[model samples]
Target: MQTQKSFEATTQGILYLVPTPIGNLEDMTFRAIRLLKEADRIAAEDTRNTQKLLNHFEIQTSQISFHEHNSKERTPFLVEKLLSGETIAQVSDAGMPSISDPGVDLVKAAIEAGITVVPLPGANAALPALIASGISPQPFYFHGFLPRKKKDLNAELETLNKRQETIIFYESPHRLKALLDQIEKVMGPERKIVLARELTKRYEEFIRGTISEVSEWAQNEQIRGEFCVILEGNANPVSENETAEWQNWTIKEHVEQVMDTEEMSSKQAIKEVSQRRSQPKRDIYAAYHEI
Candidate 1:
């Protein structure tokens, strides 16, 4: 266990995690700008994108590319520079580094090497979207980007389907409609969902409605910019105690209960039961048919 006395003066070079504006350039903080200029070098997710921000702010800081493709190769080098007392600042193309972008490995390496990591709060898409979403912001889960593959995405949604805390996810414009459709299918059509896009920019917009309604909207809108989805938590959800009761029922009996309540066919009932019990559908099917 490591305790970070962040403000304490250390002889070792510090690693500053600086956040850039998600949209508006004015959102860049003074401290972030200072750190970028003061650091020996900047490690950016995309050097070209970060260079534009640097150009706009008139902060002429040299940047080295350190994204997912090269993080493994570059982290050790950055850590060595830090250990040698050369301060480095890391930034993503937008928002905070190591968030959905890159820099986590470097930060971890820096910490292990006794290098101080000082994070400067600046701009992010999630917090603004959350505050404006009219959903419960206090106990929200930041799931970031979901899996790209449909099957993996579905499996993830299954785990998150019953969470009581408001959930936020980032999605690209091209995939937004597909993702909303998937959410509607997995989480149900009537669940409340808000899509905040182009956050903090002039074209910033919010699409708020039930999952089905938003899914419809997603299909029609000329989708542009990144998307932040703020979804309401499950209401009147099945509790663990309620699900534990299913443990007492035989597999066939459990299928019968779900079939009667949801008016689903034997096949459909088995699928739902499989998800709830975290069991393979084939296993549930075999046990049910065995009875």
Candidate 2:
């Protein structure tokens, strides 16, 4: 009896989102390799770049371009193949796709079409930078790439300066020095910063110091390769003595004191002092306006 295929055999084709290595080829996971090899077709952000990687692993899967420039036009085509039961794998040139790369749109399209999407765990730059930054990693933000325009980038940095969590960002080699200089001017020269260069590759280097110091060092070298920047958040703006004094004062007086010592706005001052003194932020705000 020619009997039996199971429920698994009837499953629709899956869209596997695989992450390629950022730098070292050895960092590529076995599971990623298996998925790529087993897939019916591989959609890459850059066929040439992905081809180099496939060549290294001796993977013979056919590749097609599926990047930002053509993703809108190509997603539907790939989806049609999935509907026909062809397993497809997607990869960016480096790191995770759809993350500062092309992959998000396609993934969204696949999901809307009711196709299964699978993400393969692999290498990334942000986590490594945050963990090695020697800063509190529990509350951290990934800011991706800085804006190329000076004014916009500075404005972006200004907002980050107020955060109490570690901030991570990616920078290009040629623009690394410029970014460091801007970070110093906007976030204060003494703000702690870590520069991770050419991560996981030969000549990988980590430079850790005050923003000004790193900026100076970066100027003396020919910057190369990708960078992951980690900036330490603003220190607690309130002092222990200030906290104790605020605890004894009326909310209005506490807000005034916070404003006088720190150059913070009234609202921000109230929030800061309230947290320091274990008081409600709203109470401080209400008293600041005599409500």
TM-score of each: 0.82, 0.78
lDDT of 1 by residue, 1-291 (tens): 888999998888999999999889999988898888898999998889889999987888788999999999999998888888888999998998888988889888888887899999989999999999988797999999999999999999977888889999999999998898888777766667999999999999998987778989878888999999999877535677987898899889999999998899999888767656655567889998994
Question: By TM-score, who's the top model here?
Answer: 1
TM-score, candidate 2, is 0.78
Query: How far is 26's C-alpha from truth in model 2 (Å)?
Result: 1.1
Candidate 2, 1-291: lDDT as tens digits: 223222235457888889999999999999999989999999998899999999999999999899989988999999999888999999998989888999898888878877778787889998887888787787888889888999999899767766788888998899998898877766656567899888888888899987778889999988888899998876664445754665678777777876888888887887665555534456667778888
Those runs of model 1 whose alpha carbons end farther than 4 Å from true positions after fitting are 239-291
Task: Give all candidates' CA lDDT scores.
Answer: 0.87, 0.82
Clashing pairs in 1: none
Q: Candidate 1, TM-score vs. the true structure?
A: 0.82
